[model samples]
Target: MASLKTTLVAATILVAVAGCAKKRPADLPPPPVDNSGPVDQGGATGPTTGAVVPGSDADFRRSVTSNTVRFGLDQYDIDPEARAILDSQSAWLQRYPNVRITIEGHCDERGTREYNLALGDRRANAAKNYLAARGVSPDRMTVISYGKERPEAMGSDDASWAQNRRAVTIVLS
Candidate 1:
């Protein structure tokens, strides 16, 4: 009787351990391998493998020189520098016909919310118009004004204010 009981207990323990083992399904594919080595940029490792995924934000950033444009104080006009940046962006947009984008306008924290909001709208529209004139479809883009609510820079100095007053383009697939 003792021998039979010991044999039963050993079998039960073996079954329990076997039940808890992790097993992958044989039909599932193996995980993708990363063949690209690490790239160093500004003390950070930027891993860029072959071919950016199509219609992706990474592709847009890789193809364009910049995704942002700066504005003068209380102004929304596209300067020469901004125009150059928009030209690159427009070219990238034309390449990816299916990708949609949103242009967000921002302002320095120096004006009332209402005034800043209005100014930001103008800035966003200015960028949109520039892109449209460069052959990108207006329907592919949307604009929003964040005004002083979302400042890129946190300080009140000239440099920070200048940095805060800008328009940023966001890629939305």
Candidate 2:
């Protein structure tokens, strides 16, 4: 009777341990290859083969001339410099039709939260409108206002304030 009981206990533990074993999943296929060549906003081409994935943030930053545009103090207008940057961004968007983006408007630390939020909205919308006018579909872009909550530069000086007041474009796949 003792021998039979010991055998039964060992069998139960072995079965439990075997049931807890991890199972391996089937292997997945490799990602598709892109044969198209790399092109810049200026119509210039670069090395055809690289590790930069398409519709990725790295690709967007590498392809566009500039992703962030600065604004004047208490202003949200698209100046000549900002316009040029947006032009390049629009071209990049045109190239990647499926990639969506978010334009974030920011403000200096001097303004009230409410005022800064409103100003930020205006800045973001200004950028979105510029891209839309350049033939980018409005549906592919989103606008957001960070106000003074997120600052690019940290300081009370002119340089920090100048850097803080801007609009930034983020690539969203």
Candidate 3:
């Protein structure tokens, strides 16, 4: 009888343990996470959000021209071309009040890392200020300096370097 009782107790504990086992939801997928550096949505490789779903980044890029403005060598000034782009961007931002963005500043691979980072920061702020002056709320925009870390064009040549020296606006949902 004692043996049977012990067996029943063990069975009850097993059942309890089995009942308490974690059951993961089958319908929901895990949130997106990038192990490498900052999370980038709808990157140069294209949208990674979903197969058919149109991503916010894609939409923003389409609505707003190139989403990028080139800077002169070692310069953070916004030229007439850059000003025109910013004007259009401001109009788009006004249309989508809820959308927030981050202006990424980049530099050519010529200056020291520290100097490039500082220059990149200045470039980012220049773009942000331009937008703010054009009526886009400063609260909706943020600036980040990639410096020469993430270059659009890879090469030591002037053409590639020119491409690298730019500020790009990315949608942050």
Candidate whose lDDT is highest: 2
Instruction: Decide which is better by TM-score, 2 or 3.
Output: 2
Q: Which portions of model 2 show Cα errors greater than 4 Å?
A: 1-50
Q: Give the alpha carbon lDDT tens digit for every residue of 1-173 in model 1.
A: 99999999999999999999999867742222121323222223234644456656666666687778999999999999999999999988988888899888889999899999999999999999999999999999999888898877789999999998988887764
- The superposed Cα distance between candidate 2 and the true structure at residue 70, in angstroms, equals 0.2
Residue-level lDDT of model 3, residues 62-149, one tens digit each, is: 6666689999999999999999888888888887888898888989999899999999999999999999998989999988887898
At residue 143, give the lDDT of candidate 3: 88
Worst lDDT run of 10 residues, candidate 2, spans: 30-39
Ranking by TM-score: 2, 1, 3
Runs in model 1 deviating more than 4 A are 1-51
Model 1: worst 10 consecutive residues (lDDT sum)? 32-41
Query: Could you tell which candidate, 2 or 3, scores higher by lDDT?
Result: 2
Question: Could you tell me the TM-score of candidate 3?
Answer: 0.69
Q: Which structure is stronger by TM-score: 1 or 3?
A: 1
TM-score of 1: 0.71
lDDT of 1: 0.82
Superior candidate under lDDT, 1 versus 3? 1
